[model samples]
Target: MDKQELGAFLRTRRERLRPEDVGLVSGARRRTPGLRREEIAVLAHISTEYYVRLEQGRAPRPSGDVLAGISAALLLTDAESEHLHLLAGTAPIQTGLHRRDVRPSILTLLERLTQTAGFVTSATFEVLAWNDLAAALMEDFGALAPADRNLARKVFLVSDGDGRGGPLYGISDRAEFRQTVVMRLRTTMARYPSDPAVIGLVEELRSGSAEFARLWERHDVQSVPMLTKTFRHPVVGDVTVDCDSLALTDRDQHLVLYSAPQGSRDAEALALLSVLGTEGIDMVPDARR
Candidate 1:
């Protein structure tokens, strides 16, 4: 690690902000350029002494995990975060838009899942592709801006369902769903530490949502397992489905499929949803007349 350069970089970034920028209070007579070393250490979940040693170029090189904590604490941009990793002798994050190409085979498979809610997403949870059933079951991914098509953005940026455009879980497992999504998201961010899209989404969420920031600070990381969620559809009432993910071996992408138990109300709802989609697809073109 370039300990001396790293020290200087940290000091400068820390000094550029005000106490209120990180939800800290400024008392009278308090004087620190941006945030004190102690405050940064606290935010990064590290020892004040250790952080001080690092800033003074007295500490050993930090691992990627330690750098990640510091990156989040400083609210570094994607480019800046990657620079931190490079200075610490860790691998830099990929500094560009997330790869969004879903394999043609995957698209065909998605189309064949008539009774399932199926969509394709990037490693960072950006919705790259989706089928009609998925569009019917959850929020419409196609309608959202390319950036807002991201699952993390939808979950964190949107408030509760009470708000006009807030996210609506429409199910009883809202907390579990959120916990799993956040855990998987943290894991994805680490896996692709330098991706500008992931870092941008995280920074945006951290700034706009205190709940997200709090959860993010905990540093929970995990894989998203096959689980079930219930969706309350306005036209079809409630539907419960098993959520499964199929990772595309060629790239950092996955196909998510949601299926309901046979003979169940959810299964019936899927059937109804398919019928609706079919009718829409079968409509005659206005210009053809």
Candidate 2:
């Protein structure tokens, strides 16, 4: 949102990196703070004048390829690269819809994995579909609002003060999990800038959560395929699950599969969850699902 701050931050980051950091060499008598403008230009495959113009915020909007070059040249973090995309108004294409209506396939897959819990979520964090085991493992997902459904939103935007939502169901280490999710979201946004759903989600988070705003300013990006999560289930008690995220490239969605070590207490709890469905329970209402 702050274009001048964005440009300044990027320039400062570039000035803090040495030529050697980006696989460049600087001979003796190099008195500059970091790599010279010409050095960065060469590394980024751009003219020195153009690079200078970019630093000065005088150049025209850059293409994605050019931004990638600059990102590499400056060693920008995933969040930073995403921030760059936002600043340049060329964020990645994040498709918000799961048009395949693959609920049946998802249910079948979940049925096959009786010992594990799994669910399918769209790029914008819509819980398109989930198996019974998944529903049992995480009770809140079954009670999500169709419009504002997402784990990240629940963690960050939910306010306990207002009796809405909060990190009531997530792990105690909520900050780290929030950062991880936001970073992943940044990566998604970078790849799908035009997705109105993603854009709207970002807007909502920015308005609703100061922590999200702070993290978003950092421009971090992360795409880890796996994560270890601990949840404090209201009914089943505390359980630890290793979550694996598989990107369904064919469908432009992702499958978040949860598993626990066999023979562990958590595993037993998950096993019990497999037998239960959304019955004989009052689903918590989440206005911003």
Candidate that scores best on TM-score: 2
Alpha-carbon local distance difference test for all models: 0.73, 0.71
Model 1 alpha-carbon miss at residue 197, Å: 1.7
Clash count per candidate: 1, 17
How well does candidate 2 score on lDDT at residue 85?
Answer: 74
- Top candidate by lDDT: 1
> What TM-score fits each model?
0.63, 0.73
Stretches of candidate 1 exceeding 4 Å from the true structure: 1-97, 161-165, 223-226, 278-289
After TM-score superposition, what is the CA distance of residue 20 in candidate 1 from its true location, in Å? 40
What are the per-residue Cα lDDT tens digits for candidate 2 across 129-232?
Answer: 77777777666465667764577777787787753337646565677767777776765665565677777888898889888888877655554444788877
lDDT of 2: 0.71
